[model samples]
Target: MHPMLNIAIRAVRRAGNLIVKNYEIVSTVKINQPNIKNITNSVKIELEKLIIDVIRKSYPEHNIITEMHGKIIGSNKDIKWTIDPLDCISNFLKCLPNFSISITLTMKNRTEIAVIYAPILNEIFSAVRGQGAQLNGYRLRCSNAVDLKGTILAIGYLLSLQQDNQKYITKINQIFKHNYIDFRRTGSVGLDMAYVAAGRVDGYFYIGLKPWNFSAGELLVRESGGLITDFNGNHTNSNNIIAANPHVLKSILLKIRNI
Candidate 1:
């Protein structure tokens, strides 16, 4: 493994450990609302701190962008680390065991390393630019499903549904009207992309995601022999994502474009 990727894995593992340790006591802690809880917030904050500390200790010059802390600039402008300390906060609060810790390292605007660790499941998904993706050190490959019929597709709501309600409803209707493909909302976009890389799902798409949410997963999909692009079939970034194998990607893109 590249030295930077090794350090990323270590940081993710540390955060995962902290999350698993506090999982059982989640309910005992106070709840703030339907999706927010004191315990989950505290855990996410602590995990972010832990990950940042680890990165800084090894590469103090690298910049950082995290869900909890927003952005931290560093002297080295060539490198930036994007992190989602807790990818599925609601799942964690509900004790659903579907949450993950995601990290991505980009150099000169190009992703160089990626890691997504699901601690409760002891599954680690990682990738290095120009290299292949992995699951627990084993090579990974995306599904080769060609058609939508009998295939499972994954979709998620935009961050702000109110602002994109008409588009969202139209897209949903178009997808369901086919009645040939099945879909799911996994709550965790990071995990959904990971599943696409691992061939656990045929494809995944979502809109209005931040860099940290899709950074690592995008690299994973690409390195795992999958195709990824924005809604218009352009190069993917943080805005909107559609990832799958070549065949499935084409099929889904055609449907999305017409909608």
Candidate 2:
């Protein structure tokens, strides 16, 4: 195992223990309670601190980027860690068991290692740059669906509605019109992409996501024999992202290209 990957696993597992404890407490409360927001927010902040502490202890010279902390620069500029301490906060607050902790390490602007831990599910999806992705300790592979027929897709929503909402919806509808079995709107990008890597879902796509939303999942998909591209099937643009095995991805791109 890579030393950095080991540290990341340690950090998320420690944070996951805290999250699970709080998850049980939140489960006892009604989602409508005012304090529910406060509790979950507190956990998120605390988890961020805990994860950063663990990383800083191991590599004091590496930079860090996080949703809560923005960016914490260290001596090393080429190596940086991107973290989403708590992904899918809405699901966590609602006790939906779909949230995750996402951590990615990049060197020279290329992802070197990625880890996404779903504490509620006790599953860890991880990948090293050249190595294949793994769920727990087992290898992962994307579904080999040759085309869209009978394939189940995972769709993620943007954090906010974009100006081209109508066009996005039109594309989704047209894609659905193809012979897919059904589509799921999971609202959790980390887990959705992890599912794609593990073949739980055939493919995943979302628009207007930031780097932290897909960095870890991006590495996982690629290591699992999948492809990531924009609506027009260009790898250069990731603002509007699509991920799937080669066959499904090509088919999806064709469906949405002219829309």
Candidate 3:
């Protein structure tokens, strides 16, 4: 493991530990108690605090990008940590145990190191720019499927936002038409992408995701002999992302392009 990636893994594990402790105390409802806002947002804020605390204490010079705080330590076009303190908040609140913490170090706007930790499952996925990906201490590899039908696709919806709900639903309707593979909506992009790297999921496609949500996962996929891009088979951004094994990547891209 690279030194930079090692640091990221440590930080993610630290944050994940905090989340594991609070996970037991979170509300079972989709929305948290005593607050009208969704449970996901509250947990996102809470985990962001923990992540930032660790980063600040160890590497105060590095900036951080967190969902709740927006941008802390630094802004765009700088060397900063892109992070989703709690990926899959709805799943976490529902006790689904699919949520994870994602952290990636961006150097001059390029992702160089990534770490994603699923605490409940004790699965820690890490990847550096050139180094391969790993889950716990074992290396990871993309699956060997060549056809879409032989793959397992992971997807999610953006129903939380009213406008995105329509877009996501429309997209999902089209995705179902593929009929080539099994599908799932685990509600966590971090885990979804990690699964892709670990070969548990063949592909993942979604929109309305923040930068921090997929940054780490993207690196994991790319380093694990998989592919990460947009619906058009272009580079992934915060707006949209499509990831899959090399052979099935084009098939996934075609399905998402029409959406």
Candidate 4:
């Protein structure tokens, strides 16, 4: 592992441990549906404090662009750390292990290293753009399934709208038919992308995501020998990502684009 990635690995692991301790001790959780995002915001802030402190103490002048509390950062230097403290709030509140702590270090918007730790399951997924992706230190390789049949893909949404959302409903219909495989909604976008990187899933697509939502994991999939693009099949931002192994990419794109 690279030196910087080593730091991210340690930090995410420590943060994950802390969150797990709190998760187990909390008897009940407040589930704010309309404000479900705030749950992530709050947890992210708390964890950000710990990470910023560690980073600042170890190496000064490293700016922090946090999703919760905004930025307590200055001009960019050689490094900018992006973080998503908690990836899946709903799952966490429901005592599910899908929630994750995501950390990434980038230089000029290009990811260098990333670490995502899912505490309940004790799974640590990490990736460096050039080095490779890993699960518990074991290397990852993209799935070679050229066809979508039995691919076991994953997809999900942020909030549930009315069934009248014909566009979305139509999408679900098309994706299901095109994928032709069992699918899941784990509620954690980071996990979705990581699964693609680790070949646990053939592909993952989501709309209305933020940079913090998929940037780190985007690098993970790409580094692990996968591809990522917008739903329209353009080389767009990770905000609306469609990632899968190269073998299935063309077919996946054709199937998805039709919807």
Best by lDDT: 2
**Please, what is the whole-model Cα lDDT of each candidate in the order they appear?**
0.86, 0.90, 0.78, 0.78
lDDT by residue for model 2 over 151-245, one digit each (tens)?
98998766467666667888889888947468987778999999999999999989888766899999999999999998899886467799999
lDDT of 1: 0.86
Off by over 4 Å in 4: 27-42, 74-76, 160-165
Error of 4 at 248 (Å): 2.1
Residue pairs that clash (backbone atoms under 3 angstroms), model 2: none
Where in model 2 is the C-alpha error above 4 Å? 31-37
Candidate 3 lDDT tens digits, 1-259? 6766667777777777777776777644344375735555666777778778877776777787766798776433467887777766667767788888888898888888888888999888888788799998799998878868756889875766778767666766666675656888788888899999988988888877766668788889999999877767877465777788877888666665776
Judge candidate 1 at residue 60 and give its lDDT: 92
Which segments of candidate 1 are over 4 A away from where they belong?
Answer: 28-38, 236-238
- The CA lDDT at 187 in model 1 is 91
- TM-score for candidate 2, please give it: 0.95
TM-score per candidate = 0.92, 0.95, 0.85, 0.89
Between prediction 1 and prediction 2, the one with superior TM-score is 2
Question: What would the per-residue lDDT of candidate 4 be over residues 1-259, giving only the tens digit for each residue?
Answer: 6877777877787788778876875437555677656655666678888777766666677877776667767554768888788877767777877888888888887888888888888898898878889999999988889888888878866564444245555765775784568778899988988999888889887767777678888888988999988767788764556789876777767765766
lDDT of 3 at 237: 66
Candidate 3 residue pairs in backbone clash = 149-180
Which is the leading candidate under TM-score?
Answer: 2
